[model samples]
Structure formats: structure tokens, C-alpha cells
Target: MTTTDVHVFFLLLCLFSPKVAAHGRIPTTLDGPFSPRTRRFDPSLRLGSDDVPMDDPKLAKKVGFNFPEQIALAISFSHTSMWVSWVTGDAQIGKNVMPLDPSTVGSEVWYGEESGKYSFVQNGTAMVYNQLYPFEGLLNYTSGIIHHVRLDGLKPGTRYYYKCGDSSLKAMSKEHTFETFPTSPDHFLRKIAVVGDLGLTLNSTSTIDHLSKNDPSLILMVGDLSYANQYLTTGGKGVPCYGCAFPDAPIRETYQPRWDGWGRFMEPLTSKIPMMVIEGNHEIEPQARGINFSSYLTRFAVPSLESHSESNFYYSFNAGGIHFIMLGAYIDYNQTGAQYAWLKKDLLKVDRELPPGLWQLGILLGDGGNIEQIDIEHADDPGKCPSKNPSIPEFGGICHLNFSSGPAKGKFCWDQQPEWSAFRESSFGHGILEVINSTYALWTWHRNQDAYKESSKGDQIYIVRQPEICLANIAKVSSKDQ
Candidate 1:
């Protein structure tokens, strides 16, 4: 063959050669400690945005008694099932209030593919919670009947229309729709929005509106859900702090109905997509005999038991190729505590082989009270964390502790950033995880100020997992047992 013929053959080879595939790439811990390139907060995005008032028509219960209000969805332990929850009946607030028996209303869900055709029926459980303030000038509250039903055997990535209510009372909700997460770990999920300290403010409305349009497959709410504690009574006035201005007040107060309003506002997005929440300090609304977190514990359903977590304060779940571990800063997290023990075990159970994807672990920290000095002492050592606690009382709780060991041993503040904290930012914002492939995923944190555009990313990284690294550890353990 002539030289021209050889050149033609080489061109053919270049045109037909298979494209090189990008696979697993592991990142070193040293590759980070990345300082988020800072951008000045836009004057337009001030914290002055007020909370949407309860009387807003959008929050009012549109349907009659037994009709579903505050409708939302949450994932169960696995992709084969999901949970649907809603509230019914009129919540009452007054000096002499009557609690509605949960049994007074039937708990049921009617769902199927075809609209207006719910041939499939599922029955579930219901309950009511009360927030009592046995003090003069303080009002009492009994919630509407809340319903929770788990729908199982669902085909992932499939859409199913659903309506929940009491068939007997003809109190069914208007048809609502939701799509399941992708069944296969390899399948790509467009976006997963994450946020923390999301109070029900006008700014929050913008955040939710933008997030809804982004159309995430999942939502991870890291806590401080509603600022219900910033009120005087169940149906009374809104105050920034219960007794800050009135130090001698006889009772701590809360506007419990704000929670209902938050739920209703969130229904537009949460009803269609699953939202997984972890407690934040704002959730600890102390009332009656020092009872706390009553509204938070009752309002949302989490996969605590399903994930082997004895309490809802912390848990773990999987979405597509990602394994998410939600930790509770308000709970006991000492290396020797129950939550810490559970966390260590839970981390050990992560299986990177089946999915062959990068494992991402996330921790959300911040609340109004002093984090246990024990954890902080370790966190604040000159060789550990070199930062002081910027404590704010708006958030509640007293779980922060000083480190018992490490360079910061016995100190109350870290001299620098703690090693375990891969990244830290104080501004209120949310995060999103986009799985690009089996061994690689992209994570981004969008500050509330940057919600409109992607210009400012508070933190972003490509999390990579080396199966070889984790598998070797597993193998070593197996051999040691032998």
C-alpha cells in the first residue's frame, strides 16, 4: 500500500476509535480546606425580609374538616416505598380548648396513575399533639389530626398521582402528583437541594420558589425549620424571643400554627418530591414543664427506625448512588455517647461496591445554645480548630461540648478550623448533590443570597471514592477475625 493509503487507514482509525471513558478518581483530604472565594452580600438580599403572616390566604386551610392540609412526602428506608403525611380537622387555641380525637377521622390514601381514578387504596395511622402552657395569659393548643401512611412496592422513577383523605366523610384532597427517585444507582438525578436555617420569611419564599423551579429529585433540610418559637401564644402575637424582652414573664410562648403555615407553604414542592429533615436548634420550642421539640417531633416523619436509628434526631438513607447520613448536633455526640456509637457503626456499614460510587457524608451544625464545651475544647485547640464559638441565642440547645482529647484538649474554643469539618460557613443556605457517575459526584452549596443565580457557590467539590481504599479496610478486618 502507498503512503497515502496508510494515511487514509490512520484517519479511519481515528474516526472509529472508541471514546475514552472517565472513571473513578479519588481526592485527597489535603486537596481541600478550600476557602470559599468570598463575595460581598448583596444589599438587596437583606435579612429584613419578614415571615409570611399566618393570615395569608395561601396558608389558610382551603378544604373542610377531614380534608388534607399540610400535605408532604418523605422517603422510607428504601426505594420500594415512600411515606405520605397530612393533617385534618381545625386546630383550636384558647383557654378552654377541646382536643380532637385522632380516631374521629379515618386515615386513608387513594392513589394511582390515572387522575381522578384512585382504584388503589391504602390505610394508615393518625394522631394529634397538644402544646400546653398552664400559665396566666398563655393560650393552649391542640393540633389537627395528623395522618401517616407508607406506600410500598413502588416502581422507582415512576409518577403516581395520589389523593389522601377519609372516604367515609367524603373529605378527599384534590389530586396531587409525585415522581419516585431513580431505581438504579447509575441513573442520574438532575438536582438535590439542601438548605439550613430556612425560616418562613419572604426570603425563604424566594428560596423555595427558585428551588421548586430547579426541580430537585430530593430535598435535605438540615434543620431550624420554622421559627415558631418567635411567638407569644398558639394564635397570639409574634415576638423574636419569648422572654428576651420580658425576662420575668411567667411562661415561654410559641405560635404553633406557624408550623401548619410552613407545611402548607411547602406542600407545593414537598407534596411532589420527598424532603428529609434533621433537627436544628429552632425546633426545640421549650414549653410546659420544660418539654421541647414537641411540634418538630410530631409534625414530620423521618426514617429513624428504618435506618436502625432509635430516634429521629439522626439517621441515614440512600438516594440513587449517594448514601446520606444526617447527624444531629443537638443530641449527644460524644465519642462515647449512644449517637456517636450509632454513627460509627452506621459509617462502617456503608457498601461502596454495590453502587460503585463515591460516598458522601454530611454533618450540619449550628443552633442557638452553647455547643457542649467538651466537643469545642477539642475543636478549638491551636493544632485542631483555631476558631472561637460565635454563639447566637436565636437558635436553642446546649449540646456543644469541649474536646476531651486532641490538641484543643480542655479548651472551650478551637484555635483554628476543626479537622473533621471539611468545610464550614455561618451564613444560612442550602446544598445540592448531583451524581455524575458511579464513582464521582458534584456537591454545591447555594447561599440564600445567591439563590437567584449560580454566580456565588458557598462551597463546591467533586467527592471521589476509592473502592480500593475502603475494600482494603474491609479485607483487613475479615483477615483479623480469622
Candidate 2:
């Protein structure tokens, strides 16, 4: 799709805990549906920035041959278990590339409650993926061995030190530590960092730096991890608009190494904090023979099997008392699809008493300072609505339609800001979710520009849950798993 044909916008809906008190009385959702608020795009800052070079110290490989790099953590279906993933060896990209054999190296993790005291051992699986473009001039790419190990039979709300690598080769990594989420929902869930469309750019560094300062316990990455598709296989300079640069290319070209760079760049934070990710459009790196999402599928390990999910694109897990259901926007979400069936089954199993209440709310997050130009125009804005036939999706049908009911009934665009949009801005930033109690959660947004001011927040709100009013509806859905 051409640049003009695709206008991308990142949407994030997350719950967070309150770190600092608001300037004044914090508005809660119980205050009724508030009026729409809009923050006009800032003109001082450029709409976009260049991606961070692969040679940058943060992205460059720091590990030795056959050593673990890009180490990261992910949560399993329960608090008693967690997933550890890392990459070994070097990725190759050229006209003729050779793929690495995962079996050559072992996947193991050594962990214990105290530092330097080995108590438990776990062995997991390893894998590799290739991005090949057989067409002339396009280079092929093969990845390093990716390993994932799940550690089970662990206590909750406790700290554990660990190291990952192949012990046989004497290539064990340095020590790392992470605390498990509290088993009870009544316990306060610390900071949960939520970001979307986070590309590797100067702005991304700022975003991540500010996020790390908050010391979040868990991270919810709302897709669009790396904008690799904006680059060609040769990987010189990346473009903001893919179609504008190489319009005649046989297929969409991507620098697969960008994935490795992103993993290394994020290793500092992801190595200690569990990051749960759902696939975004950029991850669909299509290659020869109709292959797609090869890098995304093989690199990071999600709790798909533990959650009974058939695909890695979507899954669900619990952090404290909160059950997070991560949905895949690019996948089939129709009521007749497998995803819908899974959603139905999962929702039916929700025990309100475990978390006190299941209040349905939505929060959309974007503007995470990616290389792509910031999305300023809204569908409701004048001359911005989708045409009769919008750009067709890679896998789905033309589903865009005019509002059947609402202020813009029968029209594709609304003259004013839609009522559903509580607030909108074009600045690059990240959000933090804090669950204060069973009935309340504080949501705060931090702009990258105001990184120095810890007290400053772009937006803040309290999400109050009213079980008395919503419990009746929840009782209707009986648990099928029971």
C-alpha cells in the first residue's frame, strides 16, 4: 500500500496504578461520560525522526559467539510460572544467507531465590526463522537461535535471580532478577507500562528512558514493536513511507536485523520485566511462498498454549487480580472466527470475586514516538473520512462503514470530535497503569518531552468499578469450564 493509501494510528487501552497524586481532585469514570477533549498537535516538534542506526551501542551485539543476547522475560498463564527468552549466535543478511541450527546449542536457565545460589534448573526449546525474498536484488535473512524456557512451581510475590545460556558450552549469562506478581488481586499491582507503535528512534529512546524511570513491574506492549518493513533488504536508510520509496519492488522488503536490534535495545528493561505483546501490522513481514510473521512468531514466546490459544497472535494472562486479554487487531476477529470463540470461553471463565468486579472499559493508546509520522487527522475530521472503498487489509474484508447511529449517522465523518474520544493528542508519550484497589485504577500518560519533570502528566484519570450495577449482567454468563 502507498503512503497516501495507508494512514496508520496506534490505539491503546490499558489500566494503571497511581504513582503520584494528581494536581487536584482526580476525575473518576463514575463522574459520568465526560465531554470530549482534544490537544492540538504541537508544531514545534517535527512530525517524525530517523530510526536509530544498527551500529548504535544500544542496538549492537554485546554478547560473544554462542552467548545469550537480547534476554527477556514473559509471564505464563499463572503467577507460579514465567517464561525466559533470549537469542544466541549472530544473524546473517545477504544475497546468499545461511540459517543457524538451533539444535547446535542448548537452551537452559539457572535460577534461585538468592543471588549466586543455584537451586532450580529448567530446559526449554530453541528455534530459528528466515525471511527470504527470491526475487532479484532482494537479499535473504536468517536469524540467530531463539530460546524460551518456562520455570514452574514457583512462589508468588517473590524475587528470583537467574542466568540463561548453554551450560555445556560454559556460556552462561550474567545474573538477572525479577519479582513475581502477587497471587492475590487484593494486593496492589505496581506500575504497568503500556506503549504502542514504539519504533527505534531518538524519540523511542526518550520514551523508554522515561518509562524505565517509573520502574514498572510489567510491560504491556500494544503492538508495532519495530518498523522494519519501512526499510529494504539491503538495509541502508529506512523510509517513513514504504510505498513512496520503492513502489516497484516485487514485495514489501524488511530488514530482519531490525528485530534483533530492537530486542537488544529493549534487553535492559525486558530482561528484568515481563513484556506481553500482541502482533501488529508491521510484524506481518510477508516473504516467499505466502509466509508471514516469521520473525515475530519465532523470536518472542507468548503464553498461547497455557491460555489455550491456537495462534501466537493473541492470548490472555493474569498479572495480579487483573486478567488481561490481549486481542489481535490484524487477525480475524469476527464472531464466527476462532478468536471470538476463545474470547467467549475466556470471558465466561472470569471469576468476578477473584478481582471483585469485571467492569468493561476501553482505553486507546498511541503516539509512542515511532519513526512513522504522527497521526494528526481523525476520521471525524473534515475531509478525512474513509472513502467508499478504503485500502483493503492484508487478510480481512473491507469493513469500514459510516456510522449507522450516533451524531454522524449515515455519514462517514463527524463534524466535531466524537463523544467517545475523551482526549486526543499528537505528542509522543507512554502511559502507566496502576490498580489502586479492587474497584479503582489510576491511568496516567507521560509525554517524552517532559521526562525531567516527574510530577508532570499529560492526562490522568481514575477508573472506578461499580459491581452493584454490573454484577447482574455478569451473572447471566455461566462458566463453561466449571
Candidate 3:
């Protein structure tokens, strides 16, 4: 037999071996163009998927006035710097609500490699935002002071302790610690957790609990964060879809307090590990005079200027040897647009030898429990295909087209699962990504239900890279540029 044929035979034997199965061997991408798989949704789980109430200790304010609360960390452009953020004072909601003076509270972070021995002090800006609705029966909301301070020129892969607050007022926060990502390509970040559409729900807690157990170094939150817009000015149970519930409302109503609650909910995990975020439709909380995304913009600190993108909606950052490009779906993405131009420039700077290029593979990480309900409907499923313009997006267009090729040729909906889908499940979960080396990375999905079975992983695989072919293509692109 030919060499390629012999290699294939050995791979098939190893994959089907009972011993390998018992040993929990993870399949790699080279395994095949896998057949589509659909795990049946569990009916036993409650379908209501209600939002966790604000009264929960996890969502309540933990600090006194002018003291830092809802603290979080974010990666700067590189490992030499890290961004620290938190909120101070109480947010107000109602008519005639007065905005907090950010000047009242100082934004500072005192940090050093050793515990309680701060050698460096960094001061940053503080700001507050308001969400207003001019229509009748709607209330205006003002936010607490949001602070973001960047700690710079630090040793990579080292632990540091810090506190944030107005030190002069003796309102300093309790000490917190975080480790920086390594700068070398030879070493990898411990683990990177990825989740999307995570709302404030019981299922969300399960997902977060499962993720926290894994102890990830970084988090990539692909947005749909708080679901704040799912409620009215007078807070109530979050709706599955804002448009469906408030079709005739004058403007999209938002209980801005939900954002604060979400900040508090995420502090436990985000305070140490940096969470990089991109905007999702749920973040567009529209209010008076076309104002939108006020809370989202003011609350988070991202490396926009460091990457030269200059927009919080999209940016790029590095952790260890890996470079991450976060694109904004809600922003201008045309070829002639500024975002597109920035993307082209960013792509050219990738270190092809160390970080390498990505292949065309789609991994859905959007099942992180949201009150909007788990997205189980497939465009290819019979009678389950979403209608064109089924719901209006806060931004952008939705186009539905019939498949030009594949088993369901010329069809708007497939009778069976599409061939492109490797595995599909309607369960809430989060994913962990671990780069074993420059060329190999492990991607594992952990289902919330699997918490009962600690050893159980819903799906696991090693995403392999074809360095010979892909790197050659990169060389050609480099030659063209030269």
C-alpha cells in the first residue's frame, strides 16, 4: 500500500480500538469530514429559563459608597500591561435622577509583584453615563462612577497584588491578585475560556460555576452580556425577545440597573482573569434621541487605542504568543469601511511562524445560558427554519437564502442535518481552549449537566494545523508585500 494509505489505515485502527476508547482518546480534525451529529435536547430541564433576581448576593453591591465594586481585569495590547476596572457609588433610577460627580472618587490602582508591597501607583480616568427616555411613563437612570486604570511595564507571567479606590478617602478596596500572560511563544497561556450569550440566569450560574472550576487564564465574551434591554424601565422578569414583547413601545426600554447587577455577577471570575468582549445585539439599549450603548461603552476598558483601532466596538490584543482579533458585527464592515481597513492591517502583522493562520472551522460557543432561551432552531431543520426578517436586529440586515449546493441543494430548509455540521446540541455550556504548542490546540466543550459527572466532557477535540501548506501561503503573501 502507498504511504498515505498505510497512515490512514493506522489512524482508523487507533480510532476504533477499544483500549483507546477506554483511555478517553480525543479525536483530531484530521479524523475526517465528520458526519453531522445532533444530541436530543433534554426535556427534563426547566424550559422557563428565568433570569436570576437582583436580590441574589452574587448580583448585589458588595462595597460601601465610594469604594470599588464590580472589579474586573482586562489584557492590554501586550503582556507588559493590564487594565483594571471597577465601579464606585450607587446608581440611581427614577425621574429627576442626578448623575454622580466622577471627580468625587479617584481612579487608582496600587500594585506590585509582592503582596501588600505596592511599588507602583497608576491613576486613570473616571466617568458616569445616563440612560434617558423622553417618552411618557419611562424613567431616567444615572450610573455610578466607573474607573479604569492601566498598570504598565510589568514582568510577564508574574503574579501581582493590587487595590483600587480613592486611597486618600481611606476607601481603598480589599487586595486582589492577578497573573500576567507569558511573553514567549514557546510557552502557552494555561487555558482560555470562551462563552457567549451568557445572561443573568440560574443556568448562567451553572455555566459560570463549571467554567470557574477549570481556572482559565483568559475569557473571550462574544457579548449578549446582560439582557438589560429585555426589561422595562420598571424592572420585571426578562423577556425572551425584546422586539416580541415590546413591539409597540415608543423606544426600546432598559432597566440600566441590570448592567450594574451583571457587573457584580461577573466580578468573581472577571476580577482576576481578563475578559475580552465584542458587542452583540443585546448591548444596543436605545433611549432618547437615538442614544444607545451608553452603559456598555462606559463600563468596560478595552485596548482600543493601544491597537490603533480607536473604537471599543472592535480591537486586537495579545496574550503570550497568541494574537486575538475581536471584530464588531454591529459596526461598519464593508470593504471600504474603516473597520475593514483596520482588519487588513492587523492581519498582516500576525507572526505566521509562531502564531500561524486559522483554518475555516466553525465552533458554536453561544449556548451559555441566557434568558432569551437556548437557540435550538436550525435553519436547515424542517418547519424550524427561521423566517426572513423573523425578528428585527438592533443593527444590520438578516438575509435568508436557499443553499446553492450540498444534500439540500436549492432548498431553503434541509430535511436532515446539514453535512457541514459536525456536532450540534441544544445544551447550555462553556468552552475551554488550550494551545499545546504553536501548531496544536485543544478545544473542549463542558456542558452544565456534565457537572454531575466531573470527568464528562460534552465534546473534545484537538484542532490541528497544516503548517506546511498554510505557512507557504503566508510566505507568498509576505513576498507580495515586500
Segments of candidate 3 deviating more than 4 angstroms: 1-24, 46-48, 352-362, 405-409, 452-454, 468-482
Write down the TM-score of every candidate. Answer: 0.78, 0.91, 0.90
- lDDT tens digits, residues 1-482, model 1? 00000000000000011222353453434377654232334454455546677878867778787789899999887777788999999988888789899998888989887788876888888988888888888888889998999888788878899999998988988899988777553465567776655667765776676676667898877776777776768454544444554565565577788888888888888898899887766677777777878887888888888879988888877665456677776777766688877765665566422433334344242311111100112333346543354334433544567768875678666465555555443344456666665555566666555546645666666765565785587568656645
**Candidate 2 global lDDT:** 0.80
Q: Which stretches of candidate 1 lie over 4 Å from their true place?
A: 1-38, 42-44, 234-243, 344-358, 363-429, 450-459, 466-482
Better of 1 and 3 by TM-score: 3
* 1-482 per-residue lDDT for model 3 (tens digits): 00000000000000000111122477888896999888776777644467889898889887899899999999898779999999999999998899999999899999998898999999999999999987788899999999999999989989999999999999999999999877654576668788888888998899899999999999888777888888999896688877788788787788889899999999988888899877777788988888878888999999999988968988888776677777776778777688877866776665423334443223455677888676555655667765655766555667688878888788776878767677877778788887665446678888887644557788888877676876588568657645
What lDDT does each candidate get?
A: 0.66, 0.80, 0.78
Give residue 443's error in model 1 in angstroms.
2.0
RMSD of each: 11.5, 4.0, 7.2
The TM-score-based order of candidates, best leading, equals 2, 3, 1
